[model samples]
Target: MSVQSESVTDTGPEQTVGYTLHGNRYLNITNRCTLRCAFCPRFNDEWTVQEYPLRLRRDPSFEEIVLAVGNPEEYQEIVFCGLGEPTLRLYTLLEVATRLRPHARRIRINTDGLANFVYGRDVTPDMEGLIDALSISLNAQNAEIYNRHCRPKLPGSYEAMLDFVKVAREFVPDITLTAIDGLSGVNIPACKKIAQELGVKFRRRVLDVVG
Candidate 1:
């Protein structure tokens, strides 16, 4: 509901459609999400990610999102990330990625991996050509730990997330399961083992580091 931007140029005093960090361009498409994670900055009344205020008055339009990028080739990767889950605006994300594909080096989505559950269908195939990689938040090793941290709205969300990953593997070429290493009861090694079992890459993220 509040609009603010310091890192990237604010668009029409409404929201920040894009921001840069660590050579990557991040798209803040929507502020809605499927899970309410306790560790999320927004949930703690902090909306800035790496100094860029991400609380959106409303989701940006396709044209605004593209305009925010300026030039896709300038960054190492174009990432769909923000204070919210990128997949919550699936069509917009796909459309933007499609438009940027020819010029951008790579396009990735940082997600909570609950698209299938939310949409009630397998939507992974839709990302086949547009998305270059997926950084899914595995969050915790098991359902109990996951529920405690992520606090997904729907029942069986933990299983649903894993199911989404399995189906997503056939479409997206690169998939990496990530978990915050410092979170209580989050076993980094066990999380990595899940990624190994799934035959995907794994990344151990820090507590407050974005991107």
Candidate 2:
């Protein structure tokens, strides 16, 4: 369904259980991104994932997030996920997540793994107790392929991204590093090796193409 067609201002809750969608509430922090991955749909205004449209407006305020999650106890997880990197608004996200924590069964943050450069500080340490699960995008095995595919805006961003994952594992026990299949010359074995080094779980997701 289209986000415009749906009630974008809907603050009502949809309760569910056991890893279900539970009508996930996503916040589009900023459309501007540091990475322009070859497979990224940042330029596409009509992107959709699992029926949740990725069309985004300007960055939202803490109050907007509070209102968006009128009642958080309804969803299985209050996720910080959207078309852009959530950590770009590190302070705002932490505020929102902390407020929703009391009501949410779980809190998760899906990121592109470049928070350090974006925020100019080590962002993971601040999220220790605030976030439940941290899912990061590790789309390539080596720096060469990673740079080619991810097109990160910062220098040494590939290495920095890996470092972010390593550091996050120290605080967040449930850290998962994921990659999109068939894009970055990423092999399962290599990804598993990287995850093993970082002491985190690795997953390969099927890339969805919109017609």
Best by TM-score: 1
Give the candidate number with the greatest lDDT.
Answer: 1
* Candidate 1 residue runs with Cα over 4 Å from true position: 1-7
Worst 10 residues of 1 by lDDT: 1-10
User: Cα deviation in Å at residue 159, candidate 1?
Assistant: 0.6
Q: TM-score of every model? A: 0.95, 0.84
| Global Cα lDDT for candidate 2 | 0.71
User: Residue 84 in candidate 2 has what lDDT?
Assistant: 67
Clashes of each: 0, 0
Residue range 39-118, candidate 2, lDDT tens digits: 77655544555555455555667786677666777666677766667787888889988888777877888888899877
lDDT of each: 0.89, 0.71
